[model samples]
Target: MKAKIKATWVSVFLLIAIEQTIKIIIYNNFFDKRFAILPPILYFEPMFNRHYSWFNSMLKLNAGKGLHIAVVVILSILVIVFYRFLTKRIGSIKIVNIMFAFLFSGAMCSLIDKVFWDGSLDYIMLKGFFTFDLKDLYIDVFIGLMILLLFTKNEQLKQIDEKVLLKDFLDCLLNKKHY
Candidate 1:
């Protein structure tokens, strides 16, 4: 338990550090510059995203600053609720713990941007698709993994229980045959 807790904290810190470092470097060097790596596929075009995900097109809403603050607050609350729920259910599961760490780290990374930069530094673009940052990728990947874990957890546990029951039944049969 202690080891898992330590590992979780370390992972969260490392993820946040890496996300911030990449964002800072891109902000300093690639701002307003578009570097096409794969012509029409992949490119680096740093821009400040002042809204949550692709919601910038929704409306002016509460100005950029207010929107950023609201995003941060909402994400923070959701992270807290998720952590509590996961802890209550299967906190000892290694994959679940790692998933939560990534999720929390991603949320914290976005929150940091909202609090400090008033927006997130988005650089990677898929031409006609969308633009996102490392933090966004982290969040996306972890969310998918968490969903997978949740879906398969019951199956895995049921398999384990079945195996144990089978073993016990075989043992009883062998003992009766010996007798």
Candidate 2:
């Protein structure tokens, strides 16, 4: 358990570091610039978004900075609580743990943007329909993995009846036949 917790923290930190580094590079070098990367399908266009998942824009909330910070803090607390609950109930499954790390890291990236930049730097444009960043990718991947885990009916997953020791969990992850 200790080892798992350590590994999760390391993963989270590394992800956040990489995401922020990329964001900084894009902000400095590519702000207001667009480059065709596979023209018409994908492009590197930097954009700044202050809203939370387009919810504020879709609803035309026009939320103030204070309100945005307050809402994010409340939601972040709730997410942490939910994450803890899930971890307690599901033991230390590797995929689930990795998903949590990604989720947390993505949230942290956005939070850092809100605090420092007032918005996140989105550079990956898809079909000119939408723009996103690495943080968004992390969150999207986490959600997809979470849905897969929820729908999967593997016996090994069901056999995780109690909290697993870190060594056993790592061993199981390395031993693919167990799946």
Candidate 3:
């Protein structure tokens, strides 16, 4: 494994631990299913969103405490497979590692909420503002960052590839102008 890969793995683990700690704290302290913490715009409460399929309309899969374990299992498998696929791509492993790290962290965060709350936690509510929990917000930010990074790095990678191709073309023409 490369150093960058090792670093990414470490980051994933750390993030997971942090997420779990937060979950446990919430579970132990406020498992009463009430909004324990409330700032003017936010509230910490337990919830249950059982609807499964996207938009929560179809597939009545339960999103309870046990569902958290299921999510962890499925997501872990996905991350491993995704990481392996990236490794096979030769030069794109670093990007994959970073993305995986972000995804892993987000998964851990949401998993905690599900496990402790017996379902997906949806405590956020505001009179006139958007509401989101810590886990959801973190995941969104991670995805946003990943997209930005991809676009920026893609431009640089394209430039590098072009330079290399131009050099190779010039070398071929100079050495053998048979065409």
Note the Cα lDDT for every prediction shown. 0.73, 0.76, 0.58
On TM-score, the leading prediction is 2
| Tens-digit lDDT string for candidate 1 (1-179) | 65786788799999999999988887787686888878879998888877654565456454566666686678777666545544443345677677878888888987788788877888898888878888888888898996786577455333445455445545544664221
Residue 113 lDDT, candidate 2, scale 0-100: 79
lDDT of 2 by residue, 1-179 (tens): 66886798899999999999988887787787788988869998888887755567568888776777676677666566555555654556688779888888888887787888887778888984788889989899999997898789866566655455444444544673232
Show where candidate 1 strays beyond 4 Å: 58-64, 150-179
Point out the higher-scoring one by TM-score: 2 or 3.
2
lDDT of 1 at 128: 84
List TM-scores for all candidates, in order: 0.73, 0.79, 0.56
RMSD, every candidate, angstroms: 11.4, 8.5, 10.0
For candidate 3, what's the RMSD?
Answer: 10.0
Deviation in angstroms for 5 in model 1? 1.6
Candidate 3 yields a Cα-based lDDT of 0.58
| Predicted structure 1: lDDT | 0.73
Candidate 2 ranges beyond 4 A from true positions: 154-179
lDDT of 3 by residue, 1-179 (tens): 56777788798888777656665665577656655245655555544443421233334444444655786769767666546544543344565576777777777766655555544544455535433455565567668867777677555344445455445545544764221
